[model samples]
Target: MSAFSRFTPLIRALPSTVPFVGPEAIERQRNLPVKARIGANESGFGPAPSVLAAIRARAGETWKYNDPENHDLKQALAVHLGIRADNIAIGEGIDSLLGLIVRLVIDPGSVVVTSFGAYPTFNFHANGFGCRLATVPYAGDREDLNALLDAVKREDATLVYFANPDNPMGSWWEADDIVAFTRALPETCLMILDEAYCETGPASAMPSMQALIEQPNVIRTRTFSKAYGLAGSRVGYAIGTPGTVQAFDKIRHHFGMNRIGMVAAQAALADQAYLHAVVGKIKKARERIAAIAADNGLLALPSATNFVAIDCGGDGVRARAVVDGLMQHGVFIRMPGVAPLNRCIRISVGPEHDLDLLAEALPQVLKAL
Candidate 1:
């Protein structure tokens, strides 16, 4: 039987594929089980015990639809961040929020600027919206802010994505520079500031909520996935002006949030001490990862995020070999997808056992390569 053929041209042109492959999928495809599970930037330290209790207590509410407005979560996050609840919008995660933001601002043929090899999900969302992408190369493993601003000006971009304490490379810019970048962007372009790793970065690396709150063109995204250890809960929020936030109400799935997920996020926010503890653990785990890299003669880049991107002392081929070999040993880790950066492999912060596994596998993998 023939398939229906009336889909939009954009849908037809987009390739059918899941861009970020999960560890579970790799396990199934490669007929191997993941032992360490440190590849996806997930916190193996897990969520706070209070959050787990909250989830368990709320599990019976699974049949209930979550509040479409996500009132409770937003109130909690607002208090946590000392921002007005009106300035926030909740989503399944930063990943979902990025898609909605792209859809909101981008039109077909509009230009979107981002760092080359910064975050694939942002690029994926831009492509899904049929927006033309203008990419700038990274400077010294960090997203080149000046270059990104230059590209946005050159292209007259309608949308731009910036990730401070960026992923894959795990590099970051200070708050002052980020504030300057946001101020420098023309009022004509909407900027998506993805700060999913805010929990793991330096306190000074995150700009004050009030700093960019007045700028309707800027939206800073944050998630519970990193130090909060709630990746599966899928709770993230964006901070912007009320006018900008109200736009999400127009198109977001009103009742899409899961009740248990909301409960988890609220509980997660309430436990500030736990968050601080996890951030400390993440810092320690990062040091362990860097030590493992040094043991193998690889150089780990200084990271402000939860993951460390290590220079494998060779080209992409060597980095890839180490990545593949580690996976073969049930030590799942990832590498950057582009050149220069691709010469490095990224390892997410996890428990001592996971890092122990990576420490064990990394040396053997490097020696074999």
Candidate 2:
């Protein structure tokens, strides 16, 4: 039957695509069960017991719509970050907030800058908004800050997306360098510093909140997904100047925060002890993943995120074979999508049992190749 033909030109012009093909989708498409689910950078360590309890306590209250203001979460985050509540804006996750930021700043034909193979979701959002993309290739397997800055200037771009402890390749820059990059950007260009993995990275890798919190042009996006083990909750917040963050209220989905998710995030925030413990576990898991790569003679790149990107020592074709071969054994993992970077396969930190599956499958996969 024919579909309605009233969609906007931008919507009609964009191709239907998702930034990442999730593991569940892989299972359905390939008809294989995932034994070790470590591909999407999710924390397999799980949320704190206290957070689970909080969700249970509030599950009965699910009928109630969440506070549109997101009052308690904002207050808790403000106290936790030593910033004012007004300086924060909560969203479903960094992904939703990125789309909102793009909507706020980008118009048709506006220019948006990002790393060539960085987070693809930002690019998806920019394309949905009909903005032109200006990409900078990775330098030393890391996002090239100098080139990104140059691109913004050259294109007169309105928006730029950058991630610290970046995904896929899992590379990062020191906090000082990041601070310098922020200061160096054109005031007219809004910078989204996606710090979703900040808690798992080295302290030296994160800029002091005070350093960028007041910059109107800079918005640091963080999530409860990584270190807090709350990816399912979809709770994320943006930090920026009060005036800048206030703009979200004008366009944001009022009442978008889930009640139980808010409760879990609050409970997670209150239980910093559990957070510290999980971080230690994550560090150990990262080491185990790297050791597994070394055992097979592949090089595991240094990572500040929860995942390790192991260089398969070949092109994208070889890396893809390892990914598919591992999946045949029910050990699911992922690899970068672009060249040079695509030579590496990305694995998220999971419990020892999952790594055991990986360790067993990886050698066999490489041997077959």
Which candidate number maximizes lDDT?
A: 2
**Residue pairs with clashing backbones, model 2:** none
Q: Report the CA-based lDDT of candidate 1 relative to the real structure.
A: 0.91
lDDT of 2 by residue, 1-369 (tens): 697899998898889899999899999999999999999889899999999988988799999999999999999999999999999999999999999999999999999999988999889999999999999999999999999999999999999999998987889999999999999999999999999999989999999989998799999999999999999999999999999999999999998998899999999999999999999999999999999999999999999999999999999999999999999999989998899899999999998999999999999999999
List residue ranges in candidate 2 displaced over 4 A: none
Q: Write the per-residue lDDT of candidate 1 for residues 1-369, one digit (tens) a residue.
A: 586789899998999767689998899999999999999999899999999998898789999899898988888888878899999999999999999999998899999999888899888899999999999999999999999999999999999899988998998899999999999999999999999998888889999988999999999999998888999999889999999999999999999998898899899899999999999999999999998888888799999989999998889898899989999999999999999899999999999998888888877887787
lDDT of each: 0.91, 0.94
Residue pairs whose backbone atoms clash in candidate 1: none
In terms of TM-score, how similar is model 1 to the real structure? 0.99
Using all chains and alpha carbons, the TM-scores for the candidates as numbered come to 0.99, 0.99
Candidate 1, poorest ten consecutive residues by summed lDDT? 360-369
Model 2 TM-score is 0.99
